[model samples]
Target: MTQQHLEPPVAAGLPTPVPGRAAKPSMRELILQAAAVLFYAQGIRAVSADKIITKVGITKVTFYRHFPGKDDLVVAYLERRAQSERDAIEGARRSSPGDPAGALRLIAEGIGVESCAPGFRGCPFINAAAEYADAGHPVREVVASHRRWFKATIEQILHEIGVADVSGVADQLVILRDGAMVGGHLGHRGDPQVVARSLVNAGRAVIEYSQAPD
Candidate 1:
């Protein structure tokens, strides 16, 4: 629910033009996405509205036309990151099709990679906090809601599959997931793909055990 995401549309009930609106950058969304890459790749504080305009090849006035100020830009970055995470999860679902284990495995593999932004930007939420240090910022909600939804989705899938101790399992998965991302960022010797697969195996065993009871 970052301010950017929560800000409601430019018009209450109206839809964004996307391809239908604006030119070059296309629309407000394109500007927001370009800014996210800059801010996440380099600390938010290190990037300025002027820099964003330069990178996007747009004038500061046009930037202002979309967002009132830099704070607004930061919120947009957070929302963009959350949307990326959501897309990853959705892609897993489409690729796996009812196979929760496969979906979980795909997520684990995604967390590990080289480079620093986009694929390996660490965590956008954590990066934003380092820049702003404001718990009350609109961006925090985007981070909070997305993370919460991920865990809840895991728990729901487990419940659907009749896994006993569903909540405990979901909590463990969340910890391992967040931990693996940090480990990858720090260059830890651990392979998240290996570790993630192991986690899925454990979940499979739990499913088998739960079924044995009945």
Candidate 2:
């Protein structure tokens, strides 16, 4: 007797399987991509697993198979954002090797460009944290971790630039960055270039002030 392997039933609107292999995205990737867009465009709390399933054309079974629940998916979404940020910062550092100020400027310029883009929303981590107020939640942990990394990165840069108060300067720069992101999304009065220039100038002043002779 031959063993029969039964394939899962395909839902309507979802891609049908081919004889050999299906030319479709992996269920996990599809869920993550769809959720990322929805969470960013529409707040995280506003987007539900059912909505994601509808958007991705996947069944509940598929979503659950990839993620245990909504919280799991949210964590994955944050992790993706964190990885992207780390990569961008690393690229800036590599592009301006040994020039901490230049690297910082690159990051600020990138943020400004993103803030001015069409359909621009505020920072993903900030948005997520607002919705998931529980600091102990996985989503909040990811946000906090990213923030810590960002602050530490700035401190290191300030220290390299010979700043006297690395900790204070880093804190000021982080605050300025948060403000820029909020202003870019809400204010929208000035050109993105103007916003970018202002951020760079402010960051530079922080470093300069720290370096000034007391």
Please report the candidate that would top TM-score against the real structure.
Answer: 2
lDDT of 2 at 145: 98
Question: lDDT by residue for model 1 over 106-209, one digit each (tens)?
Answer: 76556543212234555667666666655677766666777788888888777766677777778777776666556545655545456556655655665566
Q: Could you give the C-alpha RMSD of every candidate to the true structure, in order shown? A: 6.1, 9.5
The TM-score that candidate 2 achieves is 0.86
lDDT agreement of model 2 with the native: 0.80
Clashing pairs for predicted structure model 2, backbone only: none
Decoy 1 TM-score against native: 0.72
lDDT of 2 at 114: 71
